[model samples]
Every structure is written in C-alpha cells, then in structure tokens.
Target: MLSLLDVFTPAAPVWSVDDLIRYSGSPPSTCYRYLKVLCGAGFLARVANGSYVLGPRILELDRTIRLCDPVYVAGTSIAQHLTDSLGYSTLLCILFSDSVMCVQQARSRDAPPQLFNRGQRRPLIAGASAKAILAHLPLHQLRSIYAKNRKDIASGGLGSDWEHFKRALKQIRSDGYCMTVGEYNPGVMSIATGLFNRDGEVLGSLAMVAWAENSDITAFRTLTPEVVRAGQEISARIAATENMMDLPARAIG
Candidate 1:
C-alpha cells in the first residue's frame, strides 16, 4: 500500500488506475482493491481525469511533521536565526534515500532568490548541504551510492573515481563542513555542516547561501565556523528531544 503511494512525486503527481497496475505489476482486481483501500483511507483521491493524486491527508501529515518532528522544529529556528545574523538565506535539508530534501528555509532580506525551497529535492552529490550529509554516511552506503552515480560524481567534480570520491568526502569530514561555489546553481555559494542523530547517524544538513559576487573565498571561510556551530546546536537539540521521547512517561513527567 505504501509502495503505491510512493509512486507519486513532484514530477509525476497523478496516476491512472492502469498506471498503478502497470507499475506495481499487480492484477487489475488487486490494484483496484488496493486503490479502493487507499482512497477510502484518504491517502489517495480521484481526480477529474480519473487519475489519482495524493490526498489532503498528506498535507495534514506534513503539517504535523513540520510542527512536531524534532529535526524540523530545531532546524527551523536555527535556520532563521542564522539568516537573521548572517544576512544569507539558510536551508535546512534532510537526507532520504539518495536525495536531500529541503524541509526548512529562511530568507535574508538582501540575499539572492534561493534555488531550493521547502520540499524540493536535490541530488545527494550536488550541493554543499547534500555533500555535508553525504560525507558522513557509512562506507558501505557511500560505496553503493558512488557505484550508482559515478558519472554524476565525476561531473560534479566530487571525484573521477571511487577512491578519489572517498578522499573528497574524507576531506569534508576532516573539516567538519562542506563549502561550494556554483555547484548546484550558477553564481551561488553554499556552506553547510552536517546534523546528526543521538547515535551520530547523519540526519541532514544546515546551510547558508549567498551570491558569489558578494561573497569572496576568504569571507566564505569565516562563515563556515558559524554554520558548523549552528549545525551542532541543531543536532544537540534533536538528540535531547530523542532522549526525552525515550524516557518512560512517568519519568518524563
């Protein structure tokens, strides 16, 4: 059931009943049963053209996550504070699968229009935010991603081969952050640091963006420490929240 729902994306927002059956490789009766269940549960809705789109229930769930999820709650405040203090647009990105999704954004008054917005997904090897998270992933996962996206990795200048790619990510880990210029978008610069869960698993990244014209290489370095600090603070807050949630109800109270 969840697999059917996963077929809907920004690029393919609607699906006909036939489309679902073809994609799922299920018989017509089974597909219809599943679709009926999903529609009844309000996770899918029939559109004017008889295709299905994600229903309003998804919006409700998104709102709940934005309000209650520890990473979103912590990232939102920290991103806004960084934008206000640093005068650059800030992005809070989360890693899911091989993509990084922007979950929170705070725009500075004078900053250039942001290339990424909330809910937009970018390749894991494309930008500073993605690289910051990618650098911390386990070796096995990193190897898998590199094997699948070797061309993109090379084109993005991350590395020409697997060994070089590992070296590049290692450098990011050593520095505690990633910085890039015109990587994802033309003439834009991004500096990002990784956010982690209580077990030190990579959760996402917090990044600040500025126009390259207004930001020099030397100036970009100065901002990395602040962004890295913000990332650490966000990770600490999420860990604290996780710890609280793990406590017994009576103990928490």
Candidate 2:
C-alpha cells in the first residue's frame, strides 16, 4: 500500500506505468495490475495525460487523518492566531521520509497572497522550516541524510563540507530556532523552530513567513522570538497529550 502510495508524492504526483515500475521496483506486470485495480477502487485516478494520481478515496483518507492528527489539532488555532496577530503567513510541517512536507498553513487577510503551498515537500537542506527540524534530528540520521544528499546540501549552503555542515546545524541547535531571508522563496523570509514530543522526539517544525523587502532586520528581530515561542508552546502541548495517552487507565481515574 505504501509503495503504491509513494508514487503520488510531491515530486511525482502524477505517474505512468513505467514511472511506477521505476520508482516502486515492482515488475511491470505487477505494477500494471495494481494500477488498474487502484483506479477501479477509486484509490487512484487515470488522468487525461494517461498518468495516475491520487483519487477521491485518497482525499477522504487524508481528511480523516487530518481530523485526527495531533499536529493539526494542536497547531491550527495557534497558527491562525499568529497569522492574525503578526500579519504574516504561518505554516506547520512534518518530516515526510527524507524531506519535510507542509501540512497546514494560515494566511493573514492583511498579508499579500501567501505562497499557495500546502502538501508540497521541500528538501530538508533548504528552508527555515526544514533546518529547524534538521537541527534537532539525531546526529546519525542527519549524517545519513547528508551523505546521500551532499551535492544538494553544499549547493544549498548548509555547507560545502562535513565540518561546515555540522557547524551550521550546531549553530541552529544552539539558537533553538532558524531564521533565513530569501533562502527558499526569493523576496520571502521565514523563521522556524522545532516541535518535540514527551520523549524529546522531534515532531516537526512551525514557521512564519513574510515578504522580505518590506521586512527589514528590525522585523526579523521582532518576529523570531514570537515564532520560536509558538513552536515551544505547540511542542509542550504535544508532549502533554503524549504523556496523557501513555498513562494507565486507572491513573486517569
């Protein structure tokens, strides 16, 4: 199921039979069978271009998960409130395998048309949201990711070498947040911080973004702490909920 599901991700949202076989490594005959069955089941749709994409059934499943996702449950209200108060766009993101995917966003009515990206995954080596989470990841996992994506990592300015890359992450870890101007989207700047659960496991990242031209150094100085505070608050709530879930039934009573 997951292998089939992976073919419709942010990078390859549409796929042909051959594309699926290449990515999924399933035999052509087996891939053909599943694609036909999936389209028939409404789990995928045969698009006009003869490629397959996720279908209505997948949307239904996504909605169900969103309604239950702790990140969405704990984040939207705060994200919306932050957007309203700060006059910027706020977003929640989580690790989707080797990258980070946007899960939720709230745009201030006063802000310019916000970046219309929700569900798009970005390389974890690039943006403030990804960096914040990347800084908190286990060192081994971070190194593993870097080893495979070194070219992207170097080009994106995390570092050109291992020592430089480690230093960059270490600085972010020490700062407890990441701030970048025009790194991902030119003319857009962002501040991000990590979220953690009860076991101190990295949950995701929370970020606020605004136009860089109008936002000077002073604006960054003002917004960074606010975004970081919101991230910490969300992490606390997630941790508290996790702890509650871990409690014995009799303990609750």
Name the candidate that leads on lDDT: 1
Q: In order, how many clashes per candidate? A: 0, 0
Tell me the tens digit of each residue's lDDT in model 2 across 9-59: 667788887778887777888888888888788898888888888889988
Clashing pairs in 2: none
**Span of 10 residues, lowest total lDDT, candidate 2:** 244-253
Per-model TM-score on C-alpha atoms: 0.86, 0.82
Q: Candidate 1, residue 131: CA error in Å? A: 0.7
lDDT of 1: 0.85
What is the TM-score of candidate 2?
A: 0.82
Model 1, C-alpha of 52: deviation from truth (Å): 2.5
Give per-residue CA lDDT, model 1, range 157-201, as digits (tens): 889999899999999999999988889888888999998877788
Error of 2 at 16 (Å): 7.0
Q: Mark the regions of model 1 whose C-alpha exceeds 4 Å error after superposition.
A: 1-3, 6-15, 18-25, 242-253
Worst 10 residues of 1 by lDDT: 244-253
Q: Score candidate 2 by lDDT.
A: 0.78
